[model samples]
Target chain A: MMKISMPRWFYQLASPRWFYNFTSKLLPWFGIATLVFLCVGLVWGLVFAPADYQQGNSFRIIYIHVPSSILAQSCYMLMAVAGAIGLIWKMKMAHIIAQACAPIGASIAVMSLATGAIWGKPTWGAWWVWDARLTAMLVLLFLYIGVIALHAAFENKAGADKASAILSLVGLVNIPIIKYSVEWWNTLHQSATFTVTEKPAMPPEMWIPLLIMVLGFYCFFAVILMGRARVELLEREKRSDWVKQLILVNWTQ
Target chain B: MSFFLAALKRELLLVFRHRSDIINPLAFFLMVAVLFPLGVSPDPSFLSEVASGVIWVAALLACLLSVDGIFRSDYQDGSLEQMLISAEPLWMLVTAKVITHWLVSGFFLALISPLVAMMFFLPEPAYPALIISLLLGTPTLSLMGAIGSALTVGLRKGGVLISLLVLPLYIPVLIFGAGTVQAGAMGLPIQGYLALLAAILVFSLMLAPIAIVAALKISIRS
Candidate 1:
């Protein structure tokens, strides 16, 4: 029944140096966890789980499709929040993290689009239908590309960072609009099957593996993002003595 | 409001002084509309059916063509910076400039819309809907475009960059604007789409100036 106060250093962890060191230690753990969970999730979902009565084998794509779609949207939300923090606190670390997240987010979006198309060919009897959900997802992908391009388009890093941050904030208008485009219009796309409160339509056996895949994706995102941030930190803080000392110490170690 | 009027007057004078800038986008709009009939089925009914989409797309392109003009000159002359430091709030000035922008480019696009409608054989009644939709829609374009313009003010070759930034954001306006005309063409109630378009215009009118001011500050600083 005892409680202990955490050290000030715990809160100071927002410092890139602290984060780089902490995340360096955690990266390998997340990488291993990601790999272990990914293998288990893929095998369990693809091999062990029973096929759906309607979709049959094609339903298997859901394991990848749904996870990628979820990550794509969640990554945007993450970047927007990071951008907001960067704007508010003027945190360089937040900006770096936001910049790092864009490509990973865009690739995830592309995968969602590709997987949706693949799943569509079998399920909807068309490769693409211009459905609200599909179109919105496609638009989300474009928004990601737009943010990435805006970031790259400028020579001044600050300009790129701020511009991309604003674009990310503005494009968020589309996310809600996209999510509801189906409901608001009489579109071909079905309503959201995944809800927080209600049980998913798929059984626990299937959903559990899917859940693992989602966790694995998150771990993978962390691993890559940390790697990118470490590189960014070193690059941005290259002139600092601490970086040089850290490099020298690492060499000596 | 007076500032808005003054900015609009200044913008119109600039457009008149450099009239050649107007022709390219208007030509681009015409060419794009012309291509639809060449690319798609030339059947009258089909063209008429999709006329709103064609006109709306062309209008989007035309507006995009002019967005760079909104801030590029001011940025080049450093007037944007001066405005930022002046007693007049930059947002009001930017809003005025955007209003002027719509008055020239968007207004031109609206005037020529009936011709584009004729190309698609749109019925007489749909013509008014086309003008009404653009009247409500084009100001939103200028407002939104002002944000893009402010963002890309200092960049070389900002024309393409501005389009990429603004076009995705233009989707809702396009949807409701075209939906109004489409509804009119289909003999359905156009009230809903028109109301939505008007609401969007109002919303963008309120918010875009502030965003433009922020962007202009950032642009001027860098």
Candidate 2:
């Protein structure tokens, strides 16, 4: 019987020391990319993108709101997948990444909710409505907080990791259901009152900046995730020689 | 099959021995239901309109309250560790515990909800819908809450934490359970809402046991 060798990158990812060192080298590039793209995207979106004929300037909130909302949901998916990997493979680094993700995802969910509310006040004539998409976003925020709280409640790190992994997986199953049910409820009770923004098809001139913003948000998420993951790696691997030596070197320097 | 039955019988015996465990959540449910009429409006029309929502919310809280103890005693007593080491699959054992929990807490809640419903002057036609929805929805609540219980079974602060973890997942059940009764009250076709509740119940039945098993293993390992 032939034993198949795993890929070099796969082994590297499994090692916290390797991930920490690798991410340190890669972090600056992601940071620079995030900064440049965000600046360009915000400028293009705020200054150059044609205003909506109906919503006028208020529609511009979509640049921030949509990207954060998209990132929030995607971040949760990533967190659960990382958690599942950790649980299946017993990879400590995977758990660390999952832990690092919750706070960032939660903050982004908050950003999305706040921006949506701001946009809603101007467009929907209220700061909040029990709209389907908004309600799901709120639930997503609660789910993130639940993961965070469950992780904090455990005294043992490994126990915390496994418990939270199970929770996030369960939550992953509920996300789609929550999304669908909220949408169903919204339509069931939908009043004929005019919605401020109906998200019709947009020309490239308007959508291009929105695309850039979305990409920038992803890059931004990657940068912060790597930064947090690096810190987590250092904390979890603190007892190791490599981490101790690295810390000594930093202190001497 | 015998191992499953034995586990179910053991849990039933344990629950019956501590009768308060079975009765307290029911008492809590009645107290909560009673408070709505006093805290809100006494008008029958207003109470009837809010009846479904109030009952569903209280039932959800009752489920949450009872589920925290589902694995707490076994996990603390080390029997959960023994079960983990046994030859039978953890899924079967965990499912049996969840079933016992539903029988004690959710089943009684469903049986007693109609009496509480009448306090709010719920329309006569909506009574069957309320009872049927609870019957279907409460087990799903117990099953889902079991996952939360299993995860937090080893924790020092398990009670409040279980609610935080489980309540968000409980939203769809709450929506559909209340919707069934509301539809009945308004003279609309309730089959759709009841069918959705049953669909959710079926989905939870199929998937929640697997999650509960995994969660119990994690808690036990911890």
Q: What is the interface RMSD of each candidate, in Å?
A: 1.7, 0.7
Chain A, candidate 2, TM-score of 0.92
Q: Pick the candidate with the highest DockQ.
A: 2
User: How does each model score on TM-score?
Assistant: 0.93, 0.95
On a 0 to 1 DockQ scale, where is model 1? 0.50
Cα lDDT, all candidates:
0.84, 0.89
Q: Relative to the unseen true structure, what is the C-alpha lDDT of residue B72 in candidate 2, on a scale of 0 to 100?
A: 85
lDDT of 1 by residue, A1-253 (tens): 8966657774466588888878878988999999999999999999999999988899899889888988898999989888877876687888898999899999999999999899999999999997878878878888888898888888988878887888788777556744553335447865564779988877899899999999999998888888988898899899988899999998999
On TM-score, the leading prediction is 2
**Tens-digit lDDT track for model 2 on B1-222?**
998999999989999999999999999999999898888889999999999999999999999999998888888889889999988898888888889989988899999988988889999999889999999899999999999998898888888899999999999998889989999888888898888889999999999998888888878777
Determine which window of 10 residues in candidate 2 chain A has minimal summed lDDT. A187-196
TM-score of 1: 0.93
Q: What lDDT would candidate 1 get against the real structure?
A: 0.84
Candidates, DockQ: 0.50, 0.87
Backbone clashes in model 2: 0
Q: Which digits, one per residue and each the tens of the lDDT, describe model 2 over residues A49-141?
A: 999898999989989988898899999999999999898878898999999999999999999999988988878799998888888889999
lDDT at B201 for candidate 2? 90
What lDDT score goes with residue A104 in model 1? 92
